[model samples]
Target: MSFCTRFAPSPTGPLHLGHAYSALVAHDMARAQGGSFLLRFEDTDLERSKPEYVRQALDDLAWLGITWDAPPLMQSAHLGIYNQSVEGLTSRGLTYPCRCSRKDIAAALAAPQEGAPHAVYPQTCKTRSMVERGAGDAVRLHMDRALNQASAGLGFIEDGPLHCGVHPIDPAALLDEIGDIVIGRKDIQTAAYFLASAIDDMRQNITHVVRGVDLFEFTQVQILLLDLLGHTPPRYHHHDLIRDDDGKRLAKRDDARAISVYRKDGASPDDIRLMIGL
Candidate 1:
């Protein structure tokens, strides 16, 4: 495949410095490889994602001198594709309906055994079948069963400075680490971040995934999903995060670090590149 990468962002809030860093990194990598750079809106969260925010995000990227190769994809408009993926898993008995509320899950975790490893989902809905699935109930992937069906030694390569090497997946560890994670959400009839993003990565023909190191831990589960779905995982480059003066990661709440604020304060695109050490 000719190198291709994407910078997918949720339009829930304003674009911050961290978002700039991530987008610039991916764009730069694509340019360096003489390949394609794509953009996508992870707007499945209907309640949070807004048109204004999406519009502002586009302006911010353009102002920063970043250009995407094609028109961006809106995930909300493609729920059917995600549903098709969920159906494939459901048909294979690899997914089950989950009705556990956050409180219910917390209570279940609070009553866990002493020697339990990862404090992830306790599989409260492990035995629930799709026939019993009610409206609004979340659908979770049965990690163990899915792993069983996946090919052995499933993993992806990392080119990031922090963890630069090939990573191999451990089936047993993923069960405890990721557990039976939700593929379909309880709040809406859309795919969760992991499933939707992984599906897009495969379908978009993305050869590289560039994001913050904070998300590196969950890469294995996505890789597992891709392998189970018979698609190859992409190479990942998890970059260091941009933090505030207080050593905290920049968030949407931190308007002081928002890209728009910086732009309005007379920061040029070149100034941003220099500030972010690109």
Candidate 2:
């Protein structure tokens, strides 16, 4: 396939230095390889996503001399597609409905079992069939069955300089680390972040996924998701994160380090590239 990558940011907060670094890296790599660089708005969280933040992100990215190959894609606008993915998975008998809240899950895992590794959801609703799904129920994958169907020895190739290797997807690690993760929400109108992102990458024909190393741990689950969906995952290039003065990775809440603030303070695009060590 032709080279393609994307920088998808949720429009819930300011685009920080980390965002700038990621976007620049994808853009530069795409250009250098004569590939397509896409900008997508991962505004699936309707409660927190805002139109103003979307506008701000576009303005800031353009001001930084970055451009996309096509018009930006809005995750919110494509809910139907994501919804279908949820339904498709469910119909395949690979997923079941869940009604447990975060508190319910916390209570379930509050007490540790003897010599058991830490896990997320305790499978409170794993036994519930789709016919028994209630009004407020979320949808979670039947991870064990999924792994069985996906077969064994699943892995992905990472081309990122920091941690380049053939990383194997351990099913046992997945069952313990990310147990029956929420694929679709209560209303079934949208999907989880990882689920939506995995589907987006598949549909967009992305050949490379360039993001931060902070996401390395989660790559395995996404790879498994893609495999279950019968799609080949793109090569990943997980770069290092840009840290703040205290050496903490920057978050969207770091408004002081936002690209807009830097622009307002007369920091040019070249200055940003230099500051981010591009």
Q: Could you tell me every candidate's TM-score relative to the true structure? A: 0.95, 0.94
Look at candidate 2 and give me any clashing residue pairs: none
- List residue ranges in candidate 2 displaced over 4 A: 112-119
* Clash statistics: count for each candidate: 0, 0
Best by TM-score: 1
| Candidate 2: tens digits of C-alpha lDDT, residues 132-226 | 88878888989898888884778999999988999998887789877788888887676789899999998888999999999998898889888
Runs of candidate 1 with Cα error greater than 4 angstroms are 112-119
Q: Write the per-residue lDDT of candidate 1 for residues 105-215, one digit (tens) a residue.
A: 777777656244346888878998999988879999998789889887778899999999999987767876668888898764788999999999987889999999999
lDDT, each prediction: 0.90, 0.89
Error of 1 at 182 (Å): 0.7
Q: After superposition, how far is residue 137 of candidate 1 from its true place, in Å?
A: 0.8
